[model samples]
Target: MNKFLFKVSFIILFLFLGTAKTFAQKLKFLIPDAGIVQHAGSIGYFSVGAGYEIFKNKKGYLDFNYGYVPAFKGGELHAVTVKLAYKPFEIKLSDWAKLYPFNPGFFLSYTFQEDLAYKFHSSEYPRGYYYWSPALRPHLSFSNEIELSIPESWDGLGINKIGLYTEFNTNDFYIVNYLQNTSSLSLSDIFQLGIGVRLKF
Candidate 1:
């Protein structure tokens, strides 16, 4: 099942990239402004996706992602994520570089699974036994990003800029768990670290 899902993700990415240029020329809005990849966020062990700035000033982004976790690391899992991010401020370092001090985002992740919410709410468990849905997770993140100018030689590919970012994130479930068991769980226990790169076009 994991293999099949992996193949499907690859196929979808291939198709999206294959049609990107032609679509960009005819329907500019249909093309994504950037491609993104992240490692070790709450979404999964690894994720790859595309995104576009939601605002003309490049302060916000709306992204769609596909993520996977291997069996050895955890249970083999597949997830799809949609994220909205906003950067309220930035500093210019030079003509070719800029820094965003505080980038905050909210994301929803849906994992492929049976409906655990129904089971939790049924006779097997008491009412309100589980307040959160296992299949869908909501997460919050704070990130810092550095943007760099791409070389002019790569213009034909439509590539425009490159960004490297560091992220700290926590999900609703983790936060609640930590709040309930503060002694057993440290503040760091609820937080996750992720690093990613973005290629802007």
Candidate 2:
């Protein structure tokens, strides 16, 4: 179970920016903490995987991602995520900051995820848990994402958008009866902070 993630990504586009024909595409490896909300303390495993992004003058764009739980520390939680993004407007933000801003690109988004949660019975193991919200659905969900970019651009090393890229999303978790016994909000808070590198064009 040493496998953490397996994914391939690409950015395709159609555009008439009026200045010239330009295309943008990006691929990234991401780690999703699908099993984070189950933890009592902050002691938990990290998420890792890859992703792809394509932006055409910030007008038309598409993104997709997939990930797996690490076997070294995360052998029971097997998760995969796929997302689609389409932007119809232009937004801007900071580029180089340790703490990322509270904004992102893309006006609307659709996401579908499949996670195989791992259950441990050993007392030596921490109580395994999941991150589920709205606690009212059939375990499947659709979410929305807001984009926040760099505050300023440097030479070209992506020094501004590195270390931790934050995205405030919905916490969609699933358990045998855990979330079903929680709150009844339409959406939950999802704070994704992972380690990775970012590149800009």
Candidate 3:
């Protein structure tokens, strides 16, 4: 199953890259931006993905990510996620540093190799036994980001901007459970921490 998932991911990535390349010449600015991520809200140990900034000033963005979970951490899982985010404001702190004080986003993820029974009900079970599919997870997050613009001297390296970000995230299922048991569940109990970096070209 792991091998099958790897192959599917590879094929999807290949097709996306090919399509992006074909349209890049006509839509240079619309080409996807690539990045790597680590430890994102317990969704996976790590992930790599691409995103596109929308509008002339890039106030909105959309991303797609592929993540991996090791066998020891719930027996090998592959997650594919689609996210949309909006940056409300940007502050120029200095010549080198700029800050996006708030970025709120939502994501939907599908996990492959997950237990099918958890996602779907058996025929023997009555209707509405489970309200949500385990394979499909929805999350909401808010992030704070600081970006550094590279100087001309570093232009040779082909890197333009570096961003450091941290996010607080929670899933819909967790939130639902927390709401039902508000007296027992604290806000912190439903949230998770994610940290990562982004390099922009």
Candidate 3 collision pairs: none
lDDT of 2 by residue, 85-197 (tens): 34343334343223323333321222222331233333544554423222122222222233334456563643333322333333334233335654642333333333323
Model 3 error, position 110 (Å):
0.9
Ranking by TM-score: 3, 1, 2
Better of 2 and 3 by TM-score: 3
lDDT at residue 19 of model 1 (Cα atoms): 92
Clashing pairs in 1: none
Off by over 4 Å in 1: 1-27, 114-123
Q: What is the lDDT of residue 85 in candidate 3?
A: 86
lDDT-based ranking: 1, 3, 2
In order, candidate lDDTs are 0.88, 0.31, 0.82
Model 3 TM-score, 2 decimals: 0.81
Scored by lDDT, the top model is 1
